[model samples]
Structure formats: C-alpha cells, structure tokens
Target: MVSTVEVPEADAQFWRDWGDPLLVSIVDATLRANHDIRIALSRYEQSRALTHQAGLDRYPTLDVSGDVSDRRVSASQAFGLSRAHRDGELHTANLSVIWELDFFGRVRRSVESQRADTEAHAADLAGVQVAVVAEVTDAYFRLLGLQRRLQVARDNESNQADTLRLITALFQEGRGTSFDTERVRTQLAFTRSRIPPLEAEAAVTANRIAVLTGREPAAVVTMLDRSAALPVYPAQINAGVPSELLRRRPDIAAAERRLAAATARIGVATADLFPRFTLGGLVGTQALGFNTLFQRDSETRVVSLGVGGSFLDVGRVRSRIAAANSAAAESLAAYEQTVLIAMEETEDALVRLSHAQAEKAILEQAAEASRSAALTARQQFEGGMVGVLEVLDVERSRLDVENLLAQSATQQATALVAVYKTLAGGWPQLIPEPQGDAMAQR
Candidate 1:
C-alpha cells in the first residue's frame, strides 16, 4: 500500500507486470549482453583495480637489484694494477624495502577517494542496465505500434483505392465529377505514402531491440516475426512519492557516490599540506669475488627514515585543495540536480499515465463513429443517394482517427516504460558468466 507518509517500494521487476514473457526475456538478455552494460562493467572493474592500487601505498614495497662487472687495466693505466687486480669481477646484490609513513593520513584519504570512485562506477553500471532495459522496451512497443499503423495505412489505402475505382466508374457514367476522382486519387496516394516511413521505422526499431539483446538484426526480426498486440493494463499503477523515486534511481545513486568521492578527495588534497614520511631499509650482500658472495663478512644492512615537506610550495598545495573543494561543490550540485530531474521525469510519466486511458477511450470512440460513418456513406453512394465526395470525406476521417488511436496506444506503452525507468528502485543483478571464447574473439 502506497501512502503519503511512506513511499511504497517500487517492484524491482515492475516491467514484468506487462505479462509478456518475450519482454522479460528481452530485458534479461539485454542486461546480460548489451554492449553498454559490458562497458560499464569494465569501467567498474577498472575502478576496483585503481582502488586496490591506491591501497597498496599502505604497505611496504620490496625491490631486488644486482649487478656484475669485469675490469681490465691497460699498461698506461697500470698504476692502478699494483693496487688492484688487472682483471677483476665484482658482484653486488641488494634487496630494498620502502613504506610510506602516512602521519598526515594522505594515503588513507587517497584510498578512501578511490574506494568511493569504485562505488560510483558500480552505481553507474546499474544505471546503464536500467537505461538499456527501458530503451529496449520502448523500442519494442514503438515497433509494434508502427507495425499496427502500417497495417492500418495499407488497409485504408486499399479501401480508398476501391473508392477511387468507384468514382472513376461514376464519372465515366456521367454520375460524378472529375474532382471526385481526383480527390479520391489524392487520398489513396497520401495513405500509400504513410507506409514506407512506417516500415522503415519499424525495421530500425527491431534492429535496435536486437542490438540491445546482443543479437543480429536478422535474428531478432525472425524472432519477432509473429504478430503481437499491445499489452493492456486492467488498472492504473500507483506512482509513489518523489523521495522514494529519487532514493532508488541508479543515476541518483551514482551521483551521490561521486559526491562522496569528491568529498574524500578534499581530504586527500588537504593532507598534501603536511610533511611526507617513509620508512626504508636495505638488506643485502656485496663481495669483491663470487667466492665471497653471501659470506658473513660480506653482509650489508641499511635502515633509513625520510621526511619531505613543501613549505615553499604551499601555494601549489593550496591550489590543489581549492580545486578539490570546487569539485566537491560541483558534485553536490549535480547530485541535487539529478534528484530534481528524476522527480520531474517521474512526474511527467505519471501525468501521462493518468491521462492515457481517458485519451485512448476518446480516440477509440471517435474511430468507431468515423468507421460507422464511412460505411454508411459508402452505402449511400452505392444506392445513388449520396455523392463520391461525401464518401471520400468519411473515409479520410476514419483513417485519421484510427491512425491517431494507434499513436495514442504507443504513447501509453512508452510512458509506462518511462515510469519504470525513472522510479527504478532496484533491479536484480543479472550478469551472466563471461563467455571466454566469445570474449577472446572480441
């Protein structure tokens, strides 16, 4: 039960209410294979790796280095040969470690920023899934509407063609004017013109749906070849409160996460004002000959404490802090704006949904009346009680109303998709296992 005090939770699988198994499958497949989803997922993975990299600063780093050299002294330079061997091999090896001592918490702040960024990317991935599902569903409904309208246009054109033929016969029989024939011819041609564009759009929409589902356009067309009517809702769905709509939308979540990352960055920049410290050590062995390598007398050890600060470069540090603050401010504004936009979209969708049924009913009644009038006018024309002009007028009216009705139906379906997208509370995670062979090919 939705209420004023508490916003009802939107169904995560709200689109399923259309009761279309095909739609469910298409949405699921799109979530699984859509290119945008894959890209977002990859980005999320990159952020996670970056976060891990940032965290690595908290631990010691180890490095191993070694070098060997051979020396030969010329006669002219033999003054060194008396003190050192003419031919010699020298070997050195060392293992070194360095660890940042984050007394000012710079490393911690950096890691915090990266972690928040990772979360933002995760939300971005979810947002992409929401958008892809909505887009596919919208295209599917539009395709069905276009197909219906195409059929209506063709059917109307045939009827008008028959009318033109009748008018031509009447004119030949001295019972109709040339204007009557021309008028009927014009209407027939106009109706025929609507066909090509509708067919083109329908084809494009089908291809869009196929692309969303990660399939070839031809395959999608084949799968959708079977005729389908628009799904009808028996009753209106409730539009929950604005607060809940904002809370659940993935875009809002993403924006909020980014804001958090920006805030963390401010801390990171502020930490730059303090001194940096590190703990470093070296443990190794150096020998004049291979035989002395690793001997107790050849062992070496080193320990160091390093401190670095930028008291003279305070301007640069201050500038960086200012930039981070600005970024956080921008993020906060963006988050707020996103909330407003989400609310606006949800309101628009709800408004359309509210008026959808009434508008549909009105057009349906008008279509019925125009259809009846056209039939009556045709009968009167055949019975010699009416002229071709009246019959043509009625046919035009009938076609206009029906075409409008088809468009209205499509709007209703698309509006519902908008509502679900705008109010996207949550959705099931549907990432499938990566197909290794397919991925390798890509």
Candidate 2:
C-alpha cells in the first residue's frame, strides 16, 4: 500500500556536520548580518557588473543626435562664393553607429578576464564565510571554557575557605599550628586570583560573539548561559581523496580563478599589438528647414570602415603583454602556495585534535583520581593520620588537573572548528542577481 503522506525535501544548512541547533542559528544569522560577509558580497556584485560591462564592447553602439542653427553671411565677406555665400536656417538629425571589430579576439579576452574576476570574488566571499564561521565557533567554545574555569576556581576558593575555618578553630583551641593557618590563607588567596582573569576573558569572548552576529556588545551578554557544553562531531571526516581539496577549498578556488583571469588578460594585452578594426556610419536627413527634414531627396547616408593601431608605440604594447605574463606567473605561484598552506593547516589541526583528545582522556582519569585522593586525604587529616600540609597538597593537585582538563577539551573542540574551516570547499554557490536586459549581449 502507498503511504498517504509526502516527505519534504531537505535544504542545505548554513553549515554541515556540526549538529548543534543553537550554533546553526547563530551561524545563519552571522552569514546574513556580518559586516565582513556583506563587504565580500558587495565586491562580488561589483565584479558581476564589470563582467557585463566588459562584454558590452563586443557590440556596436547606436546614438541619436540632432542640431538646429540659424546662419547669415554677406556676399562681400565671402572669399570665394559658391552661390554668393548662401545663408539660411539649417536643421539636421542623424543616427550614428560605432563598432570595433574584434578580429584579434581582444573584446572576447577582456570579457573572459572580467568573468574570471567575478568568479574569484564569489570564491573570496565563500572564504570569508569559512573564516567567520570558524572564528565564531572558536570564540563560543572559548567563552564556555572560561566560564567553566571560573566556576572551578570559585569552587576551589570555597573549599579553601572551609579548610581555613577548620584550621582557624583548631588553632584557637591550641590543636593546629600557625603555619597551617597561614598556608591555607595563602592557598585561598591564590585560588581567588584565577577568577578575575577567567571572568574577563569570558566577557570579552561574549562581546566578540555579539559583534560577530552584528549586535551591540551588551546584546548577547546572557545569550549563552550553559557551561562547557562542547557538542561532539567526527574527529576525522572521510574525505575521498586529496584531489577533493581542489573543489572543497575556497582559497584554492579563488587563487585558480585569479590565475585564469591573469591568463585571459594576457590575451587581451597581446591583441593590442595588432591594428584595431572599426566601423562607423550615420543615417538621417539634413535640410534648411524642419518641414523638408523628412524629404526623400534630403536624406543623407554614410558608411565607413577603418583600422588604427600604434606603430611607434609597439614597445608599450609589448611591455603590457609582458606585464600580463608576469601577473599570470605570479598568480600561478600564489595558487600553489595557497594549496600548500591549506594542507598544512588541515594536518596541523588534525594532529592537534588527536593529541588533545588523548591528553584530555589521561587528564580525565587523573582528575577523578586526584579528587578521590584529596577527599581521602581530608578524612585522614581529620583523624590525625596526615597533616594539614598533605591535605593541602592533594587539593592543589586536583584543582590544577581540573583546569588542565577543561583547557584540553576546549582545544579539541576548537581544533575541529579549524579543520572544518580548512576544508569547507566554499559555501553553496550564491548566484548573483540577474542583470537587466540592458546588459544583455547579442
């Protein structure tokens, strides 16, 4: 039996793989509102307009013009009269045509160069997306980590305070030494010092996220209230092969587009070495009065074809071609360098994540063991099996281990974000708005 319901098609998410709903919403908002993204988008729009403008040279342009004049001249003032210096009111109008015949492919190459530039701008926009997304993710996780660290420090301070009270009462009763009391006070003071720095960093990170989302720094102060919740994603993606980097990296694509544009510009420059063919003509009527302007006999027509080129300035044209060649060569090198940097970043992030995960695992076990040992040490000290110094040492070790574990976990999360940034391949193709009919080429 056929099902009675239809399933909806899924649309592309602002990002992929990371499945946190809040993250998805924030990223979507940033992509829409971020100033850097808007700037890149505007540059892409300009390139599109320039591409259409460049294509305009491949067609003839027609212009309509007219003039009306009253003239008077004396026969005696004429040097040699062809009808004793005729004078009259004159009226004229015409439609003019001008076209550069692109026999040397100059116009075609120019259009190609501009089209490639447009593609480069599109890729640049995507690159900006990758960077901004990575930044927001890093900042979000950093804030969470700082909050956790602050909580850990405050808890340690509270624990120290309890220990200090116990030592103070014992000392007052002549059961504890002065050294113990002073040691506990100093430990509490040290624990209290960590909170301020952590609080500062968390506030700063929160402000950064707010700005990233195009809001005031105070707008998102309380937006992320959760503590140290790092959503897990695959540590290693199953990318098919290294060749996929060519398609999956926006920087690489942008560099390749730049190379292509430079190569096409070489053709544009080389074409200038040859004579440029031109066609021009006018069609209209010229009459002494407006009443006869449309008369058949008064009709005027013209047609012309000419070629113009620089013979003495050939050195300048050659120099331009040489410059274009150098530009293409530079672009090629830059493309290669971009690919190398992309690979380096990917490998670095992957290795760091792997080691961070391993380190975090070890620290997790240490943290548990340290907490258990500290608790046992406190019980033993109460029974006089150990001194206050021993208990203090164990508690300090536990605090340090907890802090390390928090940092390692945060590093691992940010490393994943970096990996995603390196391989985002480019955002979904954001096609520019359709150009007007006026820009259409025939």
Candidate 1 lDDT over residue span 1-442, tens digit each: 1111111222446557557898888888887789998898888888887887888888999999998888777757776456356777778899999999988888888888888788878778878877888899889888878887887898898898888888888899988888888988988998899899988888888999999999999888877755577776434555556666666787888899889989999988898788888899999888879889888889889999998867358999999999999999999999999988887888887788668756876887788889889999999989989887788788888888888988887887787788778778432332222322110121
Tell me each candidate's TM-score: 0.85, 0.88
Cα lDDT computed for each candidate against the true fold = 0.79, 0.79
Window of ten residues with lowest summed lDDT in model 2:
1-10
User: How many Å off is the CA of 357 in candidate 1?
Assistant: 3.3
lDDT score of residue 358 within candidate 2: 74
In candidate 1, residue 397 scores what lDDT? 88
Say which candidate scores most in lDDT. 1
Off by over 4 Å in 2: 1-19, 74-88, 225-228, 425-442
